[model samples]
Target: MVITVVYGVLAVICLGYFAGIVIYTQTVGFALFWLLTGLLLCAAGAYCAYRRKHPDRLEMPLMLKSAVFTCVSVGFLILAAAGITIFMDTEEEAPEDLDYLIVLGSKTVGREPSDTLKLRLDAALEYLQENKKTRVILSGGKGSGEDWTEAQVMYLYLKNAGVQTHRMVMETQSTDTEENVIYSLNLVKKTDTVGIVTNDFHLCRAQALARKQGKTEVYGIPAKSNWFLLPNQTVRECFALLIEKFMGNI
Candidate 1:
């Protein structure tokens, strides 16, 4: 009875932690993590119940118990399949050519680009350098902590990097990714084909949203995130994908 009670308590804690991850994180990776942890707790609860019914079976020895645990662990393999499905369904492929390059915004630390934002900016610069004829649109709004809008910061960054001001369009009123596409699209001519630049994990949703907003020819140019940040970011993106799917927002 004591063992059962202990396992029950631990199981509840594990479930609560999983719930917290879902509520706080936006990525698909968190969902996969919680799903695996929940399955483990469930298995532990089942094991406790089974032991209670056959206490004398303990004589079967530790080796047999280890084997049972190993077999039970295979359930997590299903989670991998689910994760892959979620990821693949959201990914948007890039087109061979584009007329406009749209750069999405990341968080700014007081008017300056944060490291993550810098990576995005740098990627956009590289793309612009490669495609000299493409017009660039920088989209972002001024948040509470920002000294200036994200578009303004990006404009300055690109200009300092030697991109001519005439080739850049600044959309400075969008506060989120969806808004970024919507607001920036207004600035693009109807005949133009757009290429969106954002973090690699975000490309899938960003492209989907852009298409929904009436972009006939859209492409994605993905920027890589740092290794340590990937887990959290991926988890957040999974949730974003799910929400977009549920609401038909993508």
Candidate 2:
């Protein structure tokens, strides 16, 4: 009965997390939801293994094994669900008509943009080239170390890539994803309809965050990433989605 109640509580938490992800559509919320779910499953599995090993405590070895398998199976299923979501979310489709292109930030080592950030910038640049009339907003702030802010680095990169300075705006005060949209919104005029650009695994959350910040017409432009790193990134996103849901940030 104790084990059953514990499992029930864990199941409830997992269900809440799942609902939060689908409803809030926040990456951090999904992340946190899965994080908690994973931890619970792992804990349950360990407890069952312990009970199985202690034959004097529990008379039914078969029951303990079944419980362990169930816990592990549920955990694996949750991870698989998150993986499938990431894969399905990866494709980038250009919006029909966009007034603004919002390029999200990534890490910088000194003055150079990280590979992830570069991919996002490349995708955004491609979008700009295809739609020459849209204004670009390079959004991100500086972290510890290094030279220029993410926004400045992106601006310089875009400038060097032949985009005109007049066509670009910069929002350099945002330190995180939530702040990225919040701060960027200040730079947007009332007439602008924004499309956010980020990596494929990142788009769902970014779009959700943008919508939360009142950018109703936001679209996602996702950049590509290698397959091996995809799993870790998806897992990270799931945790992030959960946190955002809890905080009501998205």
Candidate 3:
């Protein structure tokens, strides 16, 4: 009965989180994770309720139970370790006087920067102001429904904010983070001290990708993320890290 109640409460919490995300952002993204987890929790809750009524009936064999337990334990450990890797670099900052700074792009609101992209641009702007010699590569391609490529939007924002055109270059062909690093690196040497500017939760994976691409002096210039969205973004990043590892990109 207690176990059933626990699962029931957890299901409601997860489902509530899913609903809140849907209402707030309108984009599913990683919030689908909450939806699926909520449904699974609901099913688990139902099973717990059924088990409570059945008592001794439908008992599992000890060997199979042990196998399931082991798998679950191992999976939990892997996820925990991945989460730690992401969190540890959330507050990372790049050293000054980098040879190049790659500003990874996020979504755009028409021709303007979205909040996520704005944060990244703002962080990069601050760094550029301090490190005048650090050239920037604004990296992102156009996506569906976007009025302009993300790199173009970033370029406009930074240019209007007083960053000189000569100090920035646009890599408007690369669509994702891996490509962001790849195509941007083509504009400069791999031996250059490059700093990747992105949201705080994304720095770890971004830096890993840079290293995987043979960049020996890569650094992270983390931007702040919305506190309310951090949990969802962090989980999505954890899965992304795993995927990148599986694909041998990091």
* Top candidate when judged by lDDT against the true structure: 3
Q: What is the per-residue lDDT of model 2 for residues 1-250, given as tens digits with 9 covering 90 to 100?
A: 4664566577666656655554542235334545576567656656666665774784557888799789879877876765566557456566755888888898786777877788999988888888988989999998766489999999999999999999999998999888888888788876688888888888877888888877777778888764534554677777677667778887
TM-score of each: 0.67, 0.70, 0.92
- Tell me the lDDT of model 2 at 242: 61
**Pairs of colliding residues, candidate 1:** 26-236, 27-235, 27-236, 27-237, 27-238, 28-235, 28-238, 29-235
Ten residues in sequence with the least summed lDDT for candidate 2:
22-31
TM-score quality measure for candidate 1: 0.67
**lDDT string, candidate 1, 1-250, tens digits:** 7767777777776577666655653334345665676677677777778878987664557798899777767644543443464456334545544788899998777667876788888988887887778889999999766898999999988999999999999998999888998989998888888889888777778888988987857877877775655655666676677677779988
> After superposing candidate 2, which stretches have Cα over 4 Å from the reference?
1-72, 89-92
- Show how many residue pairs clash in every candidate, following the order shown: 8, 18, 0
As a whole number from 0 to 100, the lDDT of residue 183 in candidate 2 is: 82
Please name the candidate that would achieve the greatest TM-score relative to the true structure: 3
Ranking by TM-score: 3, 2, 1
Q: Give lDDT tens digits, candidate 3, residues 1-250.
A: 8888888899898889888877876677789898898898898888778878897877778999899889979987988899999879566567889999999989898889988889999999999999999999999999877999999999999999999999999999987889998999889975688889999889999888888878867888889998777888888888899999999999
